[model samples]
Target: MLPQPNRQMALAQYRLRARFYDAELAAFEPVRLRSVGCLQLQPGNTVLDVGCGTGLSLELLHKGVGPQGQIVGIEQSPEMFDLARRRVARHKWRNVTLLNAPVASATIACQADAALFHFTHDILRHPDEVRHVVGHLKPGAHVAAAGLHWGAPWDWPTNWLVWMAAMYSTTSLEGLAQPWSHLLQHLGAVQLVPSPIHGVFIVCGKVLSTGSEVVHHV
Candidate 1:
């Protein structure tokens, strides 16, 4: 398990990176598509975009959920949320709602059919946050997480890239090995797919019914 990240420090880091975040994340667009696809979104199905930065994934999500569906995006940083808000407005997506608060404390009113945790390493590391968000998910709701992780021993080059990205994006070095492990505790058995980008993975699963035995995996 990784150490918890400093929330204040993370907010500060995102404040600085918010403006350029979308451009910097362009390389991972394909991963985003596949991860979101795993949600199997349907018409009128509400979805949660956890740590949705600058709302880059909003458009794609909208395509999945359609106009009747609701998109609840919870973000912590004001600067990042600002851009995300503007993007939602620019696109005239009336169904999207942006919440500028941490997932741990955010009052998410509705139970969603699916949730996406794209590149949200800090959010994934906190069990409370994961539990809170998962609690609001409807039973059997699809959940997907994609982010950086340490590569195989022979994949030093990939690890270097993961290190550099983590340094710039995450607050703690812990869980660089398997960032999605903490989330898996709630999601049960998920399909873990490694990206060609190296050190990046996409995990998808469904929320189990209450008291369902969880299949543990590293």
Candidate 2:
């Protein structure tokens, strides 16, 4: 069986990477933009940012939601969370809320209009964590996720790149081939957006309403 994600190990990894996390993730900014765009956010919308590390996407998200909207960012690592908090303070964004807790236990008080899970492979692998985040969304709320994934079986060069990046960022390599499987299970009419970068994926979908029927995919 594939190993599950280790929270302690993830915390340790981010603790060390926190200082340079933003710089490290600079190359993936386009991926982040694409993921946030999948939300199709509007003014006054309240969005949940799952595993929001260092608040790199905050400015873009805030622009989409506008001043009337709300943003709730959840982060598990103190080192990372602290930087996110400082970013919010620096920008003086009064509408943003930061939760320094695991996504599975974070008290997300709002029924968000959308949620974005950017490069959150560890969180996506945890069923409980995905369930908790989905539960906080309003019916038919939009959901978008972007992250590294294993390429085609024969694509050794792509797979090698995915492996190296995953080793540095994710706590577990399990489900890298289908990282959005668990999240898609609760979503409806899912659509996979082609990623420009090899070994990466972007998926967008909406929460399934009670008794709602729809097609689902990764």
Candidate 3:
């Protein structure tokens, strides 16, 4: 059986990452958003950002959803959560709410127009918990995940950092990308994204439900 991590460990892992999360993902969005336009968004959408540390992506998501839309970001790490909450609050993000909890445990109080589980997928210690993320989805919502693989390059210094991370108890997400496509099959996501990007791959897919509209391969 796959070993699952408790909430405490998960939080600690993110707290460590929060310190460097923004720097690591700085150049990621432009390349990452290549998959965003494919979600076929409209006005008045609600989005769920799993493992949404420090609200780094809150601004972009809010704009994408528009004034009539809403955004929710869930993060388990208290320190990270506090930092994210402060970032959003200081920015006066009226349309956004940040929650402290595991995304898999997040309650679906609101239906989402889209959902995202980003680099966090690789950090998930348990496979079933990864699958549990599906429970929080809204009907026919757009979903995507960005995962890193062996092919992603690291310079000597960063490579050394990666090695140290692997020795740690958490957030050492090795071998996460290879299994990500399996989720596309499990979730029955249509127009699923392709693999083979520079160190990481962003996979896109749509949730299909009644009254289907359109699909994009971003």
User: For residues 33-68, could you state the per-residue lDDT of candidate 1 as single tens digits?
Assistant: 999999999999999999998999999999999999
> Candidate 2, residues 1-218: lDDT per residue as tens digits?
87899999999999999999999999998898899999999999999999999999899999999999999999999999999999999999999999999999999999999999999999999999999999999999999999999999999999999999999999899999899999877999899998878999999999999999878755
Q: Write down the RMSD of all candidates, one decimal each.
A: 1.6, 0.8, 4.7
TM-score of 3: 0.75
Backbone steric clashes in candidate 2, count: 0
Task: Give the TM-score of each candidate.
Answer: 0.95, 0.98, 0.75
Please report how far candidate 1 places residue 31 from its true position, in Å.
Answer: 0.5
- C-alpha positional error of residue 126 in candidate 2 after TM-score superposition, expressed in Å: 0.3
Once superposed on the true structure, which residue ranges of model 1 sit more than 4 Å away at CA? Answer: 1-3, 211-218
Name the best candidate (by TM-score). 2
Candidate 3, residues 98-193, lDDT tens digits: the string is: 778766666657767787766664434346555566555666677776655434354555445444544353444544335354455434445545
Provide the global lDDT of candidate 3 against the true structure: 0.63
> Where in model 3 is the C-alpha error above 4 Å?
1-9, 122-128, 152-177, 189-197, 210-218
lDDT of 2: 0.95
Candidate 1 versus the native: TM-score?
A: 0.95
Ranking by TM-score: 2, 1, 3
